[model samples]
Target: MHEERPEVGVGPWEGELPSEGHYDPELLSNGDRRNVADKYRYWSMEAIVADLDERRHDFHIAIENWQHDMNIGTVVRTANAFLAKEVHIIGRRRWNKRGAMVTDRYQHVRHHPTVEDFVVWAKGEGLAIIGIDIFPDSEKLETYELPRNCVLVFGQEGPGLSEEVHQNAEATLSIEQFGSTRSINAASAAGIAMHAWIRRHVFDQSV
Candidate 1:
């Protein structure tokens, strides 16, 4: 079962409001209960998005949606958590958004009709496409030093990355598993891959 949401909401303002452009009058009066951090309470959506845009990492997330994979929403939500520069959907334009929990509103998402189009765009943007999946020749994610600026690509749930994506990607990395299962869920893999990038580019830099 899911845990309960917080009961507390931002209380009404006590004194004169500041001149800063971040505050929202309506939210200040009517408790802000949005699914956001305390720091963003009572702030306009525009303000929150602007703040996020300033610090989003350079890496991007791309997923295949040829089969209308339900995992796409989860991947988009995870990308938002990691603050990826953008999320690219290759194949179908519309996708199931139920798993995203509205986080897609804060994310920058794009669509590509085909793998060829995605590859061409990636090349033009100078961002290397690194496929995430398990294969005989795939490198271990634990040791792989991900590209500083790259697009992390994922595939549909059951099929994994298409042969076209695999061939076009600069390299593919796989997460090691010990159990009898051949692979983890695509959404889980996407989260792990994104966090792996964070560990290398964001977390490692502070130390």
Candidate 2:
């Protein structure tokens, strides 16, 4: 006898169908196996995004995709986890989305052809661009008080932050690493930086 595969999401609505506009009819009838929270089980994609927008965080996430970085997707996923206002992709318009695991569907993403274009947009939106990378002048992320309305920008995997982005950033920060590696992975570093921001702004912790 063959073993039955375990189902992912709910099988279907067991009772009367909801009349809310946000509910997805197909998902309700078939199932809702998407990787979303229980609160958004049967919600439409547009409806889920709309509801998230109501309480999105003040900070944004920007990444340089000069090399079509694979880490970009993971960074975007982290931004979604943190409820970032939006994600700005710089350098390359197209990126690898495998690491995002479909979180990008719920996250708002924008593309900028170059660093200059991204800087202009950030300034126009009153978002200070804070770079996350190691540099001569980079400060410790542990001590930094990230601005409430800033964008945490990251660089591509190998080269790290481009000179253009480094020069334009309001400040660059580095995470403390005690291991053998010179630096952590770009995606890992991004998550740490974003969590640092959350700790200060969301939890009111300075360190």
By lDDT, the best candidate is: 2
The residue-by-residue lDDT of candidate 2 on 1-207, one tens digit each, is 999998777878999999999999999999899989899999999999999999999999999998889999899899999999999999889999999999999999999998999999999999989999999999999998899999999989899999999999999999998989999999999899989888998998553
Instruction: Give the CA lDDT, 0 to 100, for residue 116 in model 1.
Output: 96
Q: Write the per-residue lDDT of candidate 1 for residues 1-207, one digit (tens) a residue.
A: 999986766677667765678989887777787778888888888999999999999999999999999999999999999999999999999999999988999999999999999999999999999999987779999999898899999999999999999999889999999999999999999999999999998889653
RMSD of each: 2.5, 1.9
Per-prediction TM-score to the true structure, in the order listed: 0.93, 0.95
List candidate 2 segments past 4 Å from native: 1-5, 205-207
Model 1, TM vs. native: 0.93
> What ranges in model 1 sit over 4 Å off?
1-8
* Each prediction's whole-model lDDT (CA): 0.92, 0.93
Q: Highest TM-score: give the candidate number.
A: 2
